[model samples]
Every structure is written in C-alpha cells, then in structure tokens.
Target: MRAPGDLRADARRNRELIIQTARTVFAEQGPSATMDEIARHAQVGAGTLYRHFPDRDALFHAVLTDALERMIALAETTRKQEGLAWDALSRFVEGCAGLRLDLLISVAGSQATQVATTPEIGEGRARLLKILDQIVSAAHDEGTLRHDVGAGDVMGAVSLLIRGLPTLPTDLSAELKNRALRLVLAGMRTDPAPIPPPVPAMTANDLIRRLSTTGPAKPAT
Candidate 1:
C-alpha cells in the first residue's frame, strides 16, 4: 500500500472518511459489519472502499491506529491547555471515553489481540502511556491525585468503567458509564483515610509488559 502522503488529496480524504465511518460501524455492528455497509455509511463507492482498505482486516487495523493517534493528540492537547494537573488528566480521560475505545475492542473480538501486537500499535500505546504518566505524576505532585495510584491504574479503571453493557440501550449504557467514571475520579482523589491499597501500584511500563503477554479473552461456551 502507498503511504498516505503519497496519495492524492482526494484519495487521502476518501481514505480518512472510510476509516472514520468504519470505526463507527464496527463499534455498533461488531466484526460482522460488511465492507458494503461501511461504504454505504461512508457515502463512498464499493470500489473506493476496496481501493483504500482492500479488506476488513485492513480497515480494522486502520481504524485502531487512527483511534490511538487521536487519543495521543487529545492527551497532548489536554496537557498543554489545562492549568491544573487534575483538570488535564480528567479532560483527557473524558475525551478518551468519547472515543468509545471499548466499543471498538468489543467489535474486534479476537482480532484485537492480533492488531494490538502490531509494531505500530505497540509504539503508539507506549507514546500514549508516557504522556499519561507525566500527567499522573503532575497530579501527584499537586496533591490532587492519590499518591498510591499510577498511570496504569488510571487507564485500567477507565477501561473497565467505559465498557458498556451490550444488552442495555445505548443512551442508558452511556449514562451509566458517565456515572461510573465520576465515581472512579472521586475515588482517585486523596482521601483522609490513610489505608494503603492492598496491592502495589503498576507503573506504565508494567502495564505495557502485562498487555504484551495477554491473549484474547476466551469466549463463554
């Protein structure tokens, strides 16, 4: 495949549009989503979609990469613009929630394991984690965040909370996710109680290592 920079302006636009539309369709319809459906949603021709992605795996890879890049950009922007460390961290988390990353993962199923292990995705994950560690450390220094928690802890919590119930209505699931995030954020704040966490905090590097070893979750028979 040609590098994006090598594509003509119109080709690049079509490629981006197809990837964005596929992200939404896959999140809603899972791995069963068809190339024809993606093309329809993207308002592009079948040939256009194929020309850009060639196949579902290709499209899925592009969508995941795009999401990671967007999250990295959001974190960088939040870090630069927010005056308070807590505010920056919160804003970045909120933006990630909006990206619906859990939904995309749900859609990918076992394919997620393959795509995540790719060198590009691995590099992107590292970059994002590095930025998050900076934000978490800043919050710690400011005394706004609990000293026991690390960037990995924050990411792990958000991942759990943002995963919506597939059976629930979309609006209801989103509402519950928001409420859960609020509770988690509150819990992460320093409390008067001096009780230490049961387990040692996992740093960003630890998280990366753990994820590298993780396989796709087995489906319930």
Candidate 2:
C-alpha cells in the first residue's frame, strides 16, 4: 500500500474518513461488523475501502494505530502543559476516556491480540507505556498518587472503568463512565485506604505480556 503522504488529497481524505467511520462502527458492532457495512457508513465505494485496507484486520490495525498516535500526542501535550504531575495525569486519563479506547478494545476481542503482535502496534504500545511511566513516576515523586499503584495499575483501571455498560443509552453510558472515572481517580489519590496485603504492583512489562496472551472477557451467559 502507498504511504498516506504519497496519496492524493482526495485519496487521503477518503482514507481518513474510512478509518474514522470504521472506528465508530467497530465500537458499536464489534468484530462482526461487515466490510459492506463499513463501506456504506464511510460513504465510500467498496473499491476505495479495499484499496486502503484489504481486509478487516488491516482496517482494525489502522484504526488502533491512529488511536495510539493520538494518545501519545495527548500524553505529551498534557505533560508539557500541566505544571502539576497529578493534574497532568488526570487530564491525560480523561482525554483517553474521550477516545473510547475501552469500547474499541472490548469490541475487538481476540482480534486485538492478533493485531497487537504486529510490529507497528507493539512499538506504539511500548512508546505509550514509556511516556505513561514517566508521567506516573512524576506523580509518585510529587507524592500525589497512591504509593501502592503503578502506571500499569492506573492504565488497567482506566480500561475497565471507562467501558460502556451494555443496554444503556449513549448519553447515560457516557455519564456513567465519567462518574466511574472520577471515582477511580479519587481512589488513586494518596491515602485512599489500606489496599489488600502483598499484591504486587503491575509493571508495564506485565501489562504487555498480559495483552499478548489474553482476549477480552467472555460475555456472561
């Protein structure tokens, strides 16, 4: 495939439109969303969609890559602009929630693991984790974050807390997620409570390994 930069202006616009549309459709319909459905939603011809992303996996990979790049940029901006480490961290988490990453990952299911194995995806994840580690360490040094939790723990919590609950209206679901995020943020603050004894802090490496092995949770019967 041609590099995005090499594409004509119209082609580039079409590609972006497809990706954005796919991101939304995938979030709503999961892996079962069809190529025809995506093409119709993107308002692009089947040929155009195929030209950019030959298969569902390719499109999914592109969408995730786009999201990771956006996230990395958001984290960098947050760190630069927010004077207080904790404030930066909180802003970054909120920004992530807005991206609907939890919904994307939940919908991707085992496909996420497959896409994660790609070099681009793996490298993106590593870079994001490195930036997150820096922000987390700063928060720790500032004595604002709980001593017991690590960057991985915070990330894991955000992934869980931001997921949209099934059967809720979009507005209500977003409200609930925001409320949950606020609660999780409060819990992450210093002196929240006595955490259970001896649970090892989750490191970035631990998270990386886990993602490689685990799919999304199975739906309750």
Candidate 3:
C-alpha cells in the first residue's frame, strides 16, 4: 500500500482537478451542469466526485467560497496601496464585476438548489466586506464619496450592473457596463444638500444567508 503522505497528496490533486473542472464546466453549462459532467471533464470517477462533494449545493458552495476568498485577497492588496481610495475601489469593482456576473449566471442556470451558508463561506464573505468597508471609509474621510453613501451601496450598485449585463447585446455589453459604472461613481461624489436616509447596510452574514433565497432570474425582455 502507498504511504499516508502519498495518498494525501493524491487526494489533494484529485480535489483540485475536480474544482478546476467544475468551474470550467459550470461557466460553460451553468449550474444545471451535472456532477457526472464535471467528473468526466476532470477525468475522475463518480465515486471520487461524490467523495469530494456530496451534492450540487456542496459543490456550488465550494465554488462561491473560493471566489469570495480570491476577491478578499484582491481587496486587501488594493487597500494597501497609498492612493485615492476611489481608485482602489474602482479597480476592485472592475476586477470583480465579471466574476460576480459569471457566478450569478451559473447559479441562475444551474439545477442546483440554494447554496448552504457554510461557515467558511460566511467568514470569507465577512472578510471581503470588512475590506470593502475600509475602502469606503477612506473615500468618505477623503470627502470623495457622498456623506450618505456607504460600502453596501457601492456593492449594491455593482450587483445592479451585473444583473443587467445579460440583457445587453454582446457588442454593446462591455462598453455599457463601464459607462453605467462611471455614471454611478459620479453620482456618489460629495453633494451640496443632504440626501434622504438610505436603508441600513446589510451585515456580511445577512448577505450570505440571503443568497439561498434569491428567486429565479426573470427572462430578459
């Protein structure tokens, strides 16, 4: 029999391949893409796939958690640069917008049920939000963002844009997305008059918990 270390390494390699294959397959075929498909793509057996992920929800939660962790790392790196916080915020927004769009689209099209709010996913999301809060707070202190706007508002704007992206023509989509983001950013600049009170910002846990409750994506008109 192989040594324990060798077995562990082999298991780790298989898990990595499974995740990589799942990401590509999900992107191409949406969430309805089957475990069999993923296993075939990864060149692994169904038994191995089952060993790694018990169900579609488990797989999706893993994918989302991985994505969130990467975003958190990106946000932290951007935050460290001593520059206009808006610039850092804008970079993070631009980088993550496509990722968010892909994930939402996959979820919408997938056969998988709602993702479980696993603790690891929750913690990753919370860390991302914390970094975002830092960026937003810096912008507020610098008087770049309006007094009333908060980190949640910025993130919500990104989500709105992502949700609308699938509706635009392929030729016009990229350009329009940038233009729309610019318009929203301009709107967030300091204003002379006090704006009406906005809704309270959602906590990181609130955001993660609500993902499972999202309704089916309406057909684009």
Per-model TM-score, in order, reads 0.82, 0.82, 0.69
**Candidates sorted on TM-score, descending:** 2, 1, 3
- Could you arrange the candidates by lDDT from highest to lowest? 2, 1, 3
lDDT of predicted model 1: 0.78
lDDT (Cα, tens digit) per residue for candidate 2, span 1-221: 99999999999999999989887777767778888899999889999999999987888889889888988998999999999888888888888888866434655567767886799988998998899889999999989898887889977876776566744545445655766777777788885443232236446786556545654444421
Please say which candidate is ahead in lDDT: 1 or 2: 2
> What is candidate 1's TM-score against the reference?
0.82
| Candidate 2: pairs in clash | none
Clashing residue pairs for model 1: none
Q: Spell out the clash pairs found in candidate 3.
A: 31-110, 32-110, 32-111
Positional deviation of residue 179's Cα in model 2 after best superposition, in angstroms: 1.3
Q: What is candidate 3's lDDT per residue for 3-35, written digit by digit as tens?
A: 224558789788768877787677555666789
Q: Indicate the residue-level lDDT of 49 in model 2.
A: 99
Q: Per-residue lDDT for 92 in model 2?
A: 87
